[model samples]
Target chain A: MSEQFEMVPGNSLITKTPEEGRQLAVKMARLVIKATQPDSAIREKLRPIYSEDAAMLISVGQVVATEFATIAAANNYWR
Target chain B: MSEQFEMVPGNSLITKTPEEGRQLAVKMARLVIKATQPDSAIREKLRPIYSEDAAMLISVGQVVATEFATIAAANNYWR
Candidate 1:
Protein backbone atom coordinates (compact mmCIF):
# COMPACT_ATOMS: atom_id res chain seq x y z
CA MET A 1 0.00 0.00 0.00
CA SER A 2 1.60 3.25 -1.14
CA GLU A 3 0.53 5.28 1.84
CA GLN A 4 1.74 7.01 4.96
CA PHE A 5 -0.20 7.69 8.17
CA GLU A 6 -1.43 11.13 7.20
CA MET A 7 -4.60 12.06 9.04
CA VAL A 8 -7.55 11.64 6.64
CA PRO A 9 -11.27 10.99 6.94
CA GLY A 10 -12.39 8.19 9.25
CA ASN A 11 -8.96 7.55 10.70
CA SER A 12 -8.81 6.12 14.23
CA LEU A 13 -5.54 7.69 15.28
CA ILE A 14 -5.59 10.10 18.19
CA THR A 15 -4.34 13.60 17.66
CA LYS A 16 -1.86 15.34 19.96
CA THR A 17 -4.51 17.78 21.17
CA PRO A 18 -8.27 18.14 21.24
CA GLU A 19 -8.16 20.87 18.61
CA GLU A 20 -6.23 18.67 16.27
CA GLY A 21 -8.72 15.85 16.65
CA ARG A 22 -11.65 18.13 15.94
CA GLN A 23 -10.04 19.48 12.80
CA LEU A 24 -9.34 16.01 11.54
CA ALA A 25 -12.92 14.94 12.14
CA VAL A 26 -14.23 17.97 10.30
CA LYS A 27 -12.17 17.08 7.26
CA MET A 28 -13.67 13.61 7.24
CA ALA A 29 -17.19 15.00 7.52
CA ARG A 30 -16.62 17.02 4.37
CA LEU A 31 -16.00 13.85 2.47
CA VAL A 32 -19.33 12.44 3.61
CA ILE A 33 -21.19 15.59 2.73
CA LYS A 34 -19.78 15.54 -0.75
CA ALA A 35 -20.41 11.89 -1.32
CA THR A 36 -23.99 12.11 -0.14
CA GLN A 37 -24.84 15.04 -2.31
CA PRO A 38 -27.15 14.33 -5.27
CA ASP A 39 -24.44 14.16 -7.85
CA SER A 40 -22.55 11.34 -9.45
CA ALA A 41 -19.42 13.38 -10.13
CA ILE A 42 -18.75 13.96 -6.46
CA ARG A 43 -19.41 10.34 -5.70
CA GLU A 44 -16.96 9.29 -8.36
CA LYS A 45 -14.17 11.31 -6.79
CA LEU A 46 -14.87 10.09 -3.25
CA ARG A 47 -15.99 6.61 -4.22
CA PRO A 48 -12.53 5.25 -3.57
CA ILE A 49 -12.86 6.21 0.08
CA TYR A 50 -16.63 6.16 0.61
CA SER A 51 -17.93 3.58 -1.84
CA GLU A 52 -21.02 2.53 0.06
CA ASP A 53 -23.97 3.68 2.17
CA ALA A 54 -22.34 2.39 5.33
CA ALA A 55 -19.46 4.76 4.72
CA MET A 56 -21.87 7.67 4.65
CA LEU A 57 -23.38 6.79 8.00
CA ILE A 58 -19.95 6.42 9.50
CA SER A 59 -18.97 9.78 8.06
CA VAL A 60 -21.89 11.57 9.64
CA GLY A 61 -21.34 9.91 13.00
CA GLN A 62 -17.64 10.70 13.00
CA VAL A 63 -18.13 14.42 12.30
CA VAL A 64 -20.56 14.75 15.18
CA ALA A 65 -18.24 12.86 17.53
CA THR A 66 -15.28 15.01 16.64
CA GLU A 67 -17.32 18.16 17.13
CA PHE A 68 -18.20 16.93 20.57
CA ALA A 69 -14.54 16.50 21.41
CA THR A 70 -13.63 19.91 20.05
CA ILE A 71 -16.32 21.61 22.09
CA ALA A 72 -15.24 19.77 25.20
CA ALA A 73 -11.71 20.97 24.77
CA ALA A 74 -12.89 24.50 24.09
CA ASN A 75 -14.99 24.51 27.26
CA ASN A 76 -12.10 23.21 29.30
CA TYR A 77 -13.86 19.94 29.97
CA TRP A 78 -10.56 18.17 29.96
CA ARG A 79 -9.32 20.56 32.64
CA MET B 1 4.26 5.71 10.71
CA SER B 2 4.40 2.07 11.76
CA GLU B 3 1.09 1.14 10.26
CA GLN B 4 -0.44 -0.82 7.40
CA PHE B 5 -3.76 -0.40 5.55
CA GLU B 6 -5.96 -2.87 7.29
CA MET B 7 -9.68 -2.72 7.98
CA VAL B 8 -10.50 -1.09 11.32
CA PRO B 9 -12.87 1.36 12.96
CA GLY B 10 -13.35 4.83 11.45
CA ASN B 11 -11.14 3.94 8.52
CA SER B 12 -11.93 5.71 5.19
CA LEU B 13 -10.42 3.20 2.85
CA ILE B 14 -13.05 1.68 0.61
CA THR B 15 -13.49 -1.99 1.35
CA LYS B 16 -13.68 -4.50 -1.44
CA THR B 17 -17.19 -5.31 -0.39
CA PRO B 18 -20.02 -3.27 1.15
CA GLU B 19 -20.40 -5.74 3.97
CA GLU B 20 -16.81 -5.28 4.93
CA GLY B 21 -17.20 -1.51 5.03
CA ARG B 22 -20.28 -1.67 7.24
CA GLN B 23 -18.56 -4.02 9.61
CA LEU B 24 -15.67 -1.59 9.91
CA ALA B 25 -18.04 1.30 10.65
CA VAL B 26 -19.84 -0.62 13.35
CA LYS B 27 -16.52 -1.35 14.98
CA MET B 28 -15.80 2.38 15.18
CA ALA B 29 -19.17 3.21 16.68
CA ARG B 30 -18.46 0.72 19.42
CA LEU B 31 -15.32 2.63 20.21
CA VAL B 32 -17.26 5.87 20.65
CA ILE B 33 -19.89 4.24 22.82
CA LYS B 34 -17.20 2.78 25.01
CA ALA B 35 -15.23 6.00 25.31
CA THR B 36 -18.34 7.99 26.23
CA GLN B 37 -19.19 5.67 29.07
CA PRO B 38 -18.58 6.97 32.61
CA ASP B 39 -15.23 5.31 32.97
CA SER B 40 -11.68 6.47 32.54
CA ALA B 41 -10.20 3.03 32.07
CA ILE B 42 -11.88 2.46 28.72
CA ARG B 43 -10.91 5.88 27.54
CA GLU B 44 -7.34 5.18 28.52
CA LYS B 45 -7.23 2.15 26.27
CA LEU B 46 -8.78 3.97 23.29
CA ARG B 47 -7.08 7.29 23.95
CA PRO B 48 -4.37 6.72 21.39
CA ILE B 49 -7.01 6.42 18.70
CA TYR B 50 -9.95 8.42 19.99
CA SER B 51 -8.33 10.89 22.34
CA GLU B 52 -10.88 13.69 22.37
CA ASP B 53 -14.52 14.72 22.17
CA ALA B 54 -14.14 15.63 18.53
CA ALA B 55 -12.99 12.13 17.83
CA MET B 56 -16.08 10.81 19.58
CA LEU B 57 -18.40 12.89 17.41
CA ILE B 58 -16.66 11.69 14.31
CA SER B 59 -16.83 8.15 15.58
CA VAL B 60 -20.58 8.32 16.02
CA GLY B 61 -21.07 9.90 12.63
CA GLN B 62 -18.89 7.40 10.85
CA VAL B 63 -20.75 4.39 12.23
CA VAL B 64 -24.02 5.71 10.91
CA ALA B 65 -22.52 6.42 7.51
CA THR B 66 -21.25 2.89 7.18
CA GLU B 67 -24.61 1.50 8.18
CA PHE B 68 -26.28 3.55 5.51
CA ALA B 69 -23.80 2.32 2.96
CA THR B 70 -24.34 -1.27 3.96
CA ILE B 71 -28.10 -0.99 3.73
CA ALA B 72 -27.90 0.60 0.33
CA ALA B 73 -25.76 -2.20 -0.97
CA ALA B 74 -28.16 -4.74 0.42
CA ASN B 75 -31.12 -3.10 -1.36
CA ASN B 76 -29.24 -3.24 -4.62
CA TYR B 77 -29.06 0.53 -4.92
CA TRP B 78 -25.70 0.18 -6.57
CA ARG B 79 -27.34 -2.04 -9.17
Candidate 2:
Protein backbone atom coordinates (compact mmCIF):
# COMPACT_ATOMS: atom_id res chain seq x y z
CA MET A 1 0.00 0.00 0.00
CA SER A 2 1.17 3.51 -0.69
CA GLU A 3 2.32 5.32 2.43
CA GLN A 4 2.37 8.78 0.91
CA PHE A 5 -0.76 10.97 0.71
CA GLU A 6 -1.47 12.21 -2.79
CA MET A 7 -0.86 15.89 -3.42
CA VAL A 8 -3.34 17.33 -5.87
CA PRO A 9 -2.52 20.65 -7.56
CA GLY A 10 -4.86 22.76 -5.37
CA ASN A 11 -6.02 20.27 -2.77
CA SER A 12 -4.26 20.07 0.57
CA LEU A 13 -4.72 18.84 4.13
CA ILE A 14 -2.83 21.73 5.62
CA THR A 15 -5.72 23.94 6.62
CA LYS A 16 -6.04 27.68 7.26
CA THR A 17 -9.17 27.66 9.39
CA PRO A 18 -10.98 25.41 11.85
CA GLU A 19 -13.57 24.65 9.20
CA GLU A 20 -10.76 23.83 6.78
CA GLY A 21 -9.21 21.74 9.52
CA ARG A 22 -12.36 19.64 9.67
CA GLN A 23 -12.35 19.32 5.89
CA LEU A 24 -8.72 18.29 5.81
CA ALA A 25 -9.29 15.76 8.52
CA VAL A 26 -11.88 14.09 6.30
CA LYS A 27 -9.62 14.30 3.26
CA MET A 28 -6.74 12.70 5.15
CA ALA A 29 -8.98 9.91 6.39
CA ARG A 30 -10.01 9.16 2.81
CA LEU A 31 -6.38 9.20 1.73
CA VAL A 32 -5.58 6.52 4.28
CA ILE A 33 -8.46 4.43 2.94
CA LYS A 34 -7.24 4.90 -0.65
CA ALA A 35 -3.71 4.09 0.41
CA THR A 36 -4.75 0.99 2.31
CA GLN A 37 -7.26 -0.25 -0.23
CA PRO A 38 -7.02 1.29 -3.67
CA ASP A 39 -9.94 -0.65 -5.13
CA SER A 40 -13.06 1.51 -5.31
CA ALA A 41 -15.14 -1.47 -6.48
CA ILE A 42 -14.22 -3.46 -3.41
CA ARG A 43 -14.93 -0.52 -1.19
CA GLU A 44 -18.30 0.02 -2.84
CA LYS A 45 -19.21 -3.65 -2.55
CA LEU A 46 -18.31 -3.66 1.13
CA ARG A 47 -20.33 -0.51 1.73
CA PRO A 48 -23.67 -2.24 2.20
CA ILE A 49 -22.18 -4.54 4.77
CA TYR A 50 -20.34 -1.88 6.78
CA SER A 51 -22.84 0.94 6.49
CA GLU A 52 -25.58 -0.97 8.29
CA ASP A 53 -23.35 -2.37 10.99
CA ALA A 54 -23.05 0.00 13.93
CA ALA A 55 -19.79 -1.52 15.10
CA MET A 56 -18.28 -1.16 11.63
CA LEU A 57 -19.60 2.38 11.32
CA ILE A 58 -18.16 3.38 14.67
CA SER A 59 -14.90 1.89 13.62
CA VAL A 60 -15.00 4.30 10.71
CA GLY A 61 -15.38 7.11 13.23
CA GLN A 62 -12.33 5.85 15.04
CA VAL A 63 -10.28 6.16 11.88
CA VAL A 64 -11.61 9.66 11.21
CA ALA A 65 -10.78 10.66 14.78
CA THR A 66 -7.23 9.52 14.25
CA GLU A 67 -6.93 11.65 11.13
CA PHE A 68 -8.57 14.59 12.93
CA ALA A 69 -6.01 14.22 15.69
CA THR A 70 -3.19 14.53 13.21
CA ILE A 71 -4.79 17.58 11.67
CA ALA A 72 -5.38 19.02 15.11
CA ALA A 73 -1.70 18.60 15.85
CA ALA A 74 -0.72 20.29 12.62
CA ASN A 75 -2.92 23.26 13.52
CA ASN A 76 -1.68 23.16 17.11
CA TYR A 77 -5.16 22.07 18.05
CA TRP A 78 -6.45 25.03 16.10
CA ARG A 79 -4.82 27.48 18.49
CA MET B 1 -27.83 8.70 18.76
CA SER B 2 -28.46 11.86 16.81
CA GLU B 3 -29.74 11.47 13.28
CA GLN B 4 -28.95 15.03 12.29
CA PHE B 5 -25.53 16.21 11.17
CA GLU B 6 -24.55 19.22 13.27
CA MET B 7 -24.57 22.53 11.52
CA VAL B 8 -21.74 24.56 12.91
CA PRO B 9 -21.49 28.17 11.92
CA GLY B 10 -19.56 28.66 8.68
CA ASN B 11 -19.56 24.93 8.02
CA SER B 12 -21.60 23.08 5.45
CA LEU B 13 -21.44 19.99 3.23
CA ILE B 14 -23.24 21.72 0.37
CA THR B 15 -20.13 22.60 -1.59
CA LYS B 16 -19.15 24.75 -4.58
CA THR B 17 -15.97 23.01 -5.72
CA PRO B 18 -14.82 19.47 -6.46
CA GLU B 19 -12.33 19.79 -3.65
CA GLU B 20 -15.10 21.02 -1.36
CA GLY B 21 -17.15 18.05 -2.47
CA ARG B 22 -14.42 15.75 -1.30
CA GLN B 23 -14.15 17.61 1.98
CA LEU B 24 -17.89 17.45 2.60
CA ALA B 25 -17.94 13.74 1.85
CA VAL B 26 -15.41 13.15 4.60
CA LYS B 27 -17.19 15.44 7.05
CA MET B 28 -20.43 13.58 6.43
CA ALA B 29 -18.69 10.29 7.08
CA ARG B 30 -17.40 11.62 10.35
CA LEU B 31 -20.88 12.87 11.22
CA VAL B 32 -22.29 9.40 10.74
CA ILE B 33 -19.68 8.07 13.10
CA LYS B 34 -20.48 10.76 15.60
CA ALA B 35 -24.16 9.97 15.32
CA THR B 36 -23.69 6.22 15.54
CA GLN B 37 -21.44 6.44 18.56
CA PRO B 38 -21.83 9.60 20.57
CA ASP B 39 -19.36 8.87 23.29
CA SER B 40 -15.87 10.19 22.82
CA ALA B 41 -14.27 8.01 25.50
CA ILE B 42 -15.56 4.81 23.97
CA ARG B 43 -14.54 5.88 20.48
CA GLU B 44 -11.09 6.79 21.76
CA LYS B 45 -10.77 3.43 23.47
CA LEU B 46 -11.72 1.61 20.28
CA ARG B 47 -9.31 3.69 18.23
CA PRO B 48 -6.30 1.49 18.86
CA ILE B 49 -8.31 -1.60 18.01
CA TYR B 50 -9.52 -0.24 14.64
CA SER B 51 -6.39 1.67 13.68
CA GLU B 52 -4.27 -1.47 13.62
CA ASP B 53 -6.89 -3.64 11.97
CA ALA B 54 -6.94 -3.43 8.15
CA ALA B 55 -10.49 -4.73 7.78
CA MET B 56 -11.76 -2.10 10.17
CA LEU B 57 -9.83 0.63 8.36
CA ILE B 58 -11.16 -0.43 4.98
CA SER B 59 -14.61 -0.33 6.49
CA VAL B 60 -13.93 3.31 7.14
CA GLY B 61 -13.22 3.74 3.46
CA GLN B 62 -16.51 2.11 2.62
CA VAL B 63 -18.39 4.56 4.78
CA VAL B 64 -16.51 7.47 3.26
CA ALA B 65 -17.33 6.21 -0.22
CA THR B 66 -21.00 6.16 0.63
CA GLU B 67 -20.78 9.74 1.85
CA PHE B 68 -18.80 10.73 -1.22
CA ALA B 69 -21.49 9.27 -3.43
CA THR B 70 -24.09 11.41 -1.65
CA ILE B 71 -21.94 14.49 -2.04
CA ALA B 72 -21.35 13.66 -5.69
CA ALA B 73 -25.07 13.55 -6.29
CA ALA B 74 -25.54 16.86 -4.56
CA ASN B 75 -22.85 18.35 -6.80
CA ASN B 76 -24.29 16.63 -9.86
CA TYR B 77 -21.21 14.44 -9.73
CA TRP B 78 -19.20 17.62 -10.07
CA ARG B 79 -20.41 18.14 -13.65
Candidate 3:
Protein backbone atom coordinates (compact mmCIF):
# COMPACT_ATOMS: atom_id res chain seq x y z
CA MET A 1 0.00 0.00 0.00
CA SER A 2 1.11 3.53 -0.67
CA GLU A 3 2.18 5.58 2.32
CA GLN A 4 -0.43 8.08 3.45
CA PHE A 5 0.72 11.63 4.04
CA GLU A 6 -2.52 12.98 5.40
CA MET A 7 -2.86 14.33 8.92
CA VAL A 8 -4.62 11.89 11.18
CA PRO A 9 -6.33 14.22 13.62
CA GLY A 10 -6.32 13.47 17.34
CA ASN A 11 -6.24 15.11 20.75
CA SER A 12 -4.12 12.59 22.62
CA LEU A 13 -1.68 15.34 23.42
CA ILE A 14 -4.21 16.71 25.87
CA THR A 15 -3.87 13.52 27.92
CA LYS A 16 -0.37 12.34 27.14
CA THR A 17 2.27 11.81 29.84
CA PRO A 18 5.35 13.99 30.14
CA GLU A 19 7.57 11.36 28.56
CA GLU A 20 5.29 11.09 25.56
CA GLY A 21 4.99 14.84 25.40
CA ARG A 22 8.76 15.09 25.31
CA GLN A 23 8.91 12.72 22.38
CA LEU A 24 6.21 14.63 20.57
CA ALA A 25 7.97 17.90 21.26
CA VAL A 26 11.08 16.70 19.51
CA LYS A 27 9.05 15.29 16.68
CA MET A 28 7.24 18.60 16.23
CA ALA A 29 10.57 20.42 16.06
CA ARG A 30 11.78 18.07 13.35
CA LEU A 31 8.47 18.41 11.57
CA VAL A 32 8.85 22.18 11.44
CA ILE A 33 12.31 21.79 9.91
CA LYS A 34 11.09 19.37 7.30
CA ALA A 35 8.01 21.43 6.54
CA THR A 36 9.91 24.70 6.25
CA GLN A 37 12.57 23.16 4.09
CA PRO A 38 11.07 20.50 1.88
CA ASP A 39 14.25 20.12 -0.09
CA SER A 40 16.19 17.21 1.39
CA ALA A 41 19.34 17.89 -0.60
CA ILE A 42 19.56 21.44 0.71
CA ARG A 43 18.87 20.24 4.22
CA GLU A 44 21.69 17.72 3.92
CA LYS A 45 23.98 20.44 2.63
CA LEU A 46 23.09 22.74 5.53
CA ARG A 47 23.48 20.05 8.18
CA PRO A 48 27.21 20.52 8.52
CA ILE A 49 26.90 24.27 9.06
CA TYR A 50 24.44 23.70 11.90
CA SER A 51 26.40 20.80 13.35
CA GLU A 52 29.50 22.96 13.54
CA ASP A 53 27.70 25.86 15.20
CA ALA A 54 27.38 25.46 18.94
CA ALA A 55 24.81 28.25 19.19
CA MET A 56 22.69 26.76 16.42
CA LEU A 57 22.57 23.38 18.11
CA ILE A 58 21.65 25.00 21.39
CA SER A 59 18.88 26.97 19.69
CA VAL A 60 17.46 23.76 18.26
CA GLY A 61 17.46 22.22 21.72
CA GLN A 62 15.78 25.35 23.03
CA VAL A 63 12.97 24.98 20.49
CA VAL A 64 12.43 21.39 21.61
CA ALA A 65 12.52 22.48 25.24
CA THR A 66 9.91 25.12 24.51
CA GLU A 67 7.70 22.49 22.90
CA PHE A 68 8.20 20.24 25.90
CA ALA A 69 7.15 22.98 28.30
CA THR A 70 4.05 23.75 26.25
CA ILE A 71 3.11 20.08 26.08
CA ALA A 72 3.62 19.73 29.80
CA ALA A 73 1.16 22.53 30.34
CA ALA A 74 -1.38 21.06 27.90
CA ASN A 75 -1.18 17.86 29.94
CA ASN A 76 -1.93 20.01 32.99
CA TYR A 77 1.63 19.74 34.22
CA TRP A 78 0.82 16.04 34.63
CA ARG A 79 -0.80 16.86 37.93
CA MET B 1 15.41 38.14 -3.99
CA SER B 2 14.65 34.52 -3.23
CA GLU B 3 12.38 33.67 -0.33
CA GLN B 4 14.31 31.77 2.30
CA PHE B 5 12.75 28.74 3.98
CA GLU B 6 15.55 28.31 6.51
CA MET B 7 14.62 28.06 10.15
CA VAL B 8 16.20 31.01 11.88
CA PRO B 9 17.41 29.46 15.12
CA GLY B 10 16.18 31.25 18.23
CA ASN B 11 14.95 30.80 21.79
CA SER B 12 12.36 33.58 21.60
CA LEU B 13 9.60 31.19 22.51
CA ILE B 14 11.18 30.83 25.92
CA THR B 15 10.66 34.52 26.57
CA LYS B 16 7.56 35.40 24.53
CA THR B 17 4.38 36.72 26.13
CA PRO B 18 1.15 34.70 26.22
CA GLU B 19 -0.30 36.46 23.18
CA GLU B 20 2.84 35.83 21.18
CA GLY B 21 2.97 32.27 22.40
CA ARG B 22 -0.62 31.72 21.30
CA GLN B 23 0.19 32.94 17.82
CA LEU B 24 3.25 30.74 17.65
CA ALA B 25 1.26 27.76 18.91
CA VAL B 26 -1.20 28.08 16.04
CA LYS B 27 1.69 28.59 13.65
CA MET B 28 3.44 25.48 14.88
CA ALA B 29 0.28 23.48 14.35
CA ARG B 30 0.10 24.70 10.75
CA LEU B 31 3.78 23.99 10.29
CA VAL B 32 3.20 20.37 11.24
CA ILE B 33 0.45 20.12 8.65
CA LYS B 34 2.60 21.65 5.93
CA ALA B 35 5.58 19.52 6.85
CA THR B 36 3.65 16.28 6.92
CA GLN B 37 1.75 16.82 3.68
CA PRO B 38 4.38 18.74 1.73
CA ASP B 39 1.86 19.18 -1.06
CA SER B 40 -0.29 22.25 -1.30
CA ALA B 41 -2.68 20.72 -3.81
CA ILE B 42 -3.34 17.75 -1.55
CA ARG B 43 -3.84 20.00 1.45
CA GLU B 44 -6.35 22.13 -0.39
CA LYS B 45 -8.28 19.05 -1.46
CA LEU B 46 -8.26 17.67 2.07
CA ARG B 47 -9.43 20.94 3.53
CA PRO B 48 -13.03 20.58 2.43
CA ILE B 49 -13.32 17.16 4.03
CA TYR B 50 -11.94 18.37 7.33
CA SER B 51 -14.07 21.49 7.23
CA GLU B 52 -17.25 19.44 6.76
CA ASP B 53 -16.56 17.02 9.59
CA ALA B 54 -17.39 18.40 13.03
CA ALA B 55 -15.21 15.92 14.87
CA MET B 56 -12.31 16.63 12.58
CA LEU B 57 -12.71 20.35 13.15
CA ILE B 58 -12.86 19.84 16.89
CA SER B 59 -9.73 17.76 16.80
CA VAL B 60 -8.03 20.53 14.91
CA GLY B 61 -9.15 23.00 17.55
CA GLN B 62 -8.00 20.66 20.27
CA VAL B 63 -4.59 20.56 18.70
CA VAL B 64 -4.54 24.34 18.73
CA ALA B 65 -5.88 24.41 22.28
CA THR B 66 -3.20 21.99 23.36
CA GLU B 67 -0.63 24.17 21.71
CA PHE B 68 -2.06 27.28 23.33
CA ALA B 69 -2.07 25.68 26.74
CA THR B 70 1.47 24.48 26.25
CA ILE B 71 2.61 27.89 25.16
CA ALA B 72 0.85 29.50 28.10
CA ALA B 73 2.72 27.16 30.41
CA ALA B 74 5.99 27.86 28.64
CA ASN B 75 5.20 31.49 29.34
CA ASN B 76 4.57 30.41 32.92
CA TYR B 77 0.84 30.58 32.25
CA TRP B 78 1.40 34.26 31.78
CA ARG B 79 1.93 34.58 35.49
Candidate 4:
Protein backbone atom coordinates (compact mmCIF):
# COMPACT_ATOMS: atom_id res chain seq x y z
CA MET A 1 0.00 0.00 0.00
CA SER A 2 2.69 2.38 -0.73
CA GLU A 3 1.75 5.33 -2.85
CA GLN A 4 4.21 3.99 -5.42
CA PHE A 5 1.75 1.18 -6.14
CA GLU A 6 -0.73 3.76 -7.34
CA MET A 7 -0.63 3.74 -11.16
CA VAL A 8 0.07 7.32 -12.07
CA PRO A 9 1.31 8.81 -15.29
CA GLY A 10 5.10 9.07 -15.75
CA ASN A 11 5.38 6.71 -12.77
CA SER A 12 6.68 3.22 -13.44
CA LEU A 13 5.45 0.70 -10.93
CA ILE A 14 8.11 -1.75 -12.08
CA THR A 15 11.10 0.33 -10.95
CA LYS A 16 10.54 -0.23 -7.23
CA THR A 17 12.16 -2.84 -4.97
CA PRO A 18 11.80 -6.32 -6.39
CA GLU A 19 9.19 -7.35 -3.85
CA GLU A 20 7.06 -4.26 -4.37
CA GLY A 21 7.49 -4.44 -8.11
CA ARG A 22 6.43 -8.06 -8.12
CA GLN A 23 3.32 -7.20 -6.17
CA LEU A 24 2.39 -4.40 -8.50
CA ALA A 25 3.17 -6.53 -11.51
CA VAL A 26 0.75 -9.13 -10.18
CA LYS A 27 -2.04 -6.57 -10.15
CA MET A 28 -1.24 -5.53 -13.70
CA ALA A 29 -1.11 -9.16 -14.78
CA ARG A 30 -4.57 -9.74 -13.48
CA LEU A 31 -5.89 -6.81 -15.46
CA VAL A 32 -4.13 -7.94 -18.62
CA ILE A 33 -5.38 -11.48 -18.25
CA LYS A 34 -8.93 -10.33 -17.92
CA ALA A 35 -8.62 -8.02 -20.86
CA THR A 36 -6.95 -10.52 -23.14
CA GLN A 37 -8.65 -13.81 -22.37
CA PRO A 38 -9.57 -15.46 -25.67
CA ASP A 39 -13.24 -15.84 -24.83
CA SER A 40 -13.58 -12.45 -23.24
CA ALA A 41 -15.66 -9.78 -24.96
CA ILE A 42 -12.89 -7.22 -24.82
CA ARG A 43 -10.45 -9.62 -26.40
CA GLU A 44 -12.89 -10.21 -29.21
CA LYS A 45 -12.99 -6.49 -29.84
CA LEU A 46 -9.23 -6.03 -29.65
CA ARG A 47 -8.35 -9.02 -31.80
CA PRO A 48 -9.00 -7.38 -35.14
CA ILE A 49 -7.52 -4.08 -34.07
CA TYR A 50 -4.23 -5.71 -33.07
CA SER A 51 -4.18 -8.45 -35.66
CA GLU A 52 -0.88 -7.38 -37.11
CA ASP A 53 0.98 -8.09 -33.87
CA ALA A 54 -0.54 -11.37 -32.84
CA ALA A 55 2.77 -12.79 -31.70
CA MET A 56 3.55 -9.78 -29.58
CA LEU A 57 0.09 -9.95 -28.09
CA ILE A 58 0.63 -13.58 -27.17
CA SER A 59 4.04 -12.79 -25.77
CA VAL A 60 2.60 -10.13 -23.53
CA GLY A 61 -0.02 -12.57 -22.35
CA GLN A 62 2.65 -15.08 -21.48
CA VAL A 63 4.73 -12.46 -19.71
CA VAL A 64 1.79 -11.54 -17.54
CA ALA A 65 1.14 -15.16 -16.70
CA THR A 66 4.76 -15.76 -15.78
CA GLU A 67 4.97 -12.60 -13.70
CA PHE A 68 1.83 -13.51 -11.82
CA ALA A 69 3.26 -16.96 -11.09
CA THR A 70 6.43 -15.37 -9.75
CA ILE A 71 4.44 -13.07 -7.51
CA ALA A 72 2.36 -15.95 -6.24
CA ALA A 73 5.49 -17.87 -5.37
CA ALA A 74 7.09 -14.97 -3.54
CA ASN A 75 3.99 -13.93 -1.59
CA ASN A 76 2.59 -17.44 -1.09
CA TYR A 77 -0.56 -15.88 -2.49
CA TRP A 78 -1.69 -19.21 -3.92
CA ARG A 79 -0.42 -21.65 -1.35
CA MET B 1 -4.84 20.59 -26.13
CA SER B 2 -6.94 17.85 -24.62
CA GLU B 3 -6.61 16.40 -21.12
CA GLN B 4 -6.10 12.99 -22.71
CA PHE B 5 -2.61 14.06 -23.70
CA GLU B 6 -1.57 13.82 -20.06
CA MET B 7 0.72 10.83 -19.40
CA VAL B 8 -1.23 8.99 -16.75
CA PRO B 9 -1.34 5.28 -16.17
CA GLY B 10 -4.79 3.63 -16.47
CA ASN B 11 -5.23 6.32 -19.13
CA SER B 12 -3.57 5.39 -22.39
CA LEU B 13 -2.98 8.44 -24.55
CA ILE B 14 -2.53 6.16 -27.55
CA THR B 15 -6.19 5.14 -27.55
CA LYS B 16 -7.25 8.57 -28.70
CA THR B 17 -7.81 9.65 -32.29
CA PRO B 18 -4.77 9.02 -34.49
CA GLU B 19 -3.86 12.70 -34.55
CA GLU B 20 -4.02 13.07 -30.81
CA GLY B 21 -2.26 9.79 -30.24
CA ARG B 22 0.49 10.82 -32.65
CA GLN B 23 1.02 14.06 -30.81
CA LEU B 24 1.21 12.41 -27.40
CA ALA B 25 3.51 9.74 -28.81
CA VAL B 26 5.86 12.51 -29.91
CA LYS B 27 6.05 13.87 -26.41
CA MET B 28 6.81 10.41 -25.05
CA ALA B 29 9.38 9.99 -27.81
CA ARG B 30 11.18 13.09 -26.65
CA LEU B 31 11.42 11.75 -23.13
CA VAL B 32 12.68 8.36 -24.32
CA ILE B 33 15.25 9.98 -26.58
CA LYS B 34 16.62 12.00 -23.68
CA ALA B 35 16.74 8.98 -21.43
CA THR B 36 18.44 6.58 -23.83
CA GLN B 37 20.93 8.70 -25.71
CA PRO B 38 24.33 7.00 -26.00
CA ASP B 39 27.08 8.76 -24.05
CA SER B 40 24.34 10.08 -21.82
CA ALA B 41 24.72 9.46 -18.07
CA ILE B 42 21.34 7.79 -17.69
CA ARG B 43 21.97 5.36 -20.53
CA GLU B 44 25.23 4.42 -18.90
CA LYS B 45 23.40 3.69 -15.66
CA LEU B 46 20.76 1.61 -17.46
CA ARG B 47 23.12 -0.31 -19.73
CA PRO B 48 24.53 -2.59 -17.05
CA ILE B 49 21.14 -3.25 -15.50
CA TYR B 50 19.45 -4.10 -18.82
CA SER B 51 22.31 -5.89 -20.49
CA GLU B 52 20.33 -9.04 -21.12
CA ASP B 53 17.73 -7.20 -23.20
CA ALA B 54 19.89 -4.90 -25.22
CA ALA B 55 17.94 -5.57 -28.40
CA MET B 56 14.63 -4.79 -26.78
CA LEU B 57 16.01 -1.54 -25.46
CA ILE B 58 17.22 -0.63 -28.90
CA SER B 59 13.87 -1.53 -30.44
CA VAL B 60 12.11 0.80 -28.04
CA GLY B 61 14.49 3.55 -29.06
CA GLN B 62 13.65 2.99 -32.71
CA VAL B 63 9.92 2.90 -32.00
CA VAL B 64 10.11 6.28 -30.32
CA ALA B 65 12.09 7.75 -33.17
CA THR B 66 9.64 6.40 -35.74
CA GLU B 67 6.63 7.61 -33.82
CA PHE B 68 8.09 11.07 -33.52
CA ALA B 69 8.74 11.18 -37.23
CA THR B 70 5.18 10.04 -37.95
CA ILE B 71 3.81 12.78 -35.74
CA ALA B 72 5.98 15.36 -37.39
CA ALA B 73 4.75 14.31 -40.82
CA ALA B 74 1.05 14.37 -39.91
CA ASN B 75 1.22 17.74 -38.19
CA ASN B 76 3.70 19.27 -40.59
CA TYR B 77 5.63 20.10 -37.46
CA TRP B 78 8.93 19.70 -39.23
CA ARG B 79 7.96 21.53 -42.36
Best by TM-score: 2
CAPRI-style docking class of model 4 based on DockQ: incorrect
| lDDT at residue B9 of model 4 (Cα atoms) | 24
* Candidate 4 lDDT by residue in tens digits, B1-79: 0122222222232233556646555454433223223234544554454345665456544544554443344344533
Tens digit per residue, CA lDDT, model 2, B1-79:
8646583313655666545665566566666667789888987787656655556776666665556555545555343
Candidate 2, residue A20: lDDT: 77
lDDT of 2: 0.60
Model 4 clash pairs? A9-B8
Q: Rank the candidates by DockQ, best first.
A: 1, 2, 3, 4
TM-score order of candidates, top first = 2, 3, 1, 4
Error of 1 at A67 (Å): 6.2
| lDDT score of residue A3 within candidate 4 | 35
TM-scores vs. true structure, each candidate: 0.27, 0.48, 0.45, 0.26
Ranking by lDDT: 2, 3, 1, 4
RMSD of 2: 14.2
The models' CA-based lDDT, in order, is 0.44, 0.60, 0.55, 0.40
Question: DockQ of each candidate's interface versus the true one?
Answer: 0.07, 0.07, 0.04, 0.02
Question: How much is A41 displaced in model 4, in angstroms?
Answer: 11
Best by lDDT: 2
- The TM-score measured for candidate 4 stands at 0.26
What clash pairs does model 3 have?
A70-B70
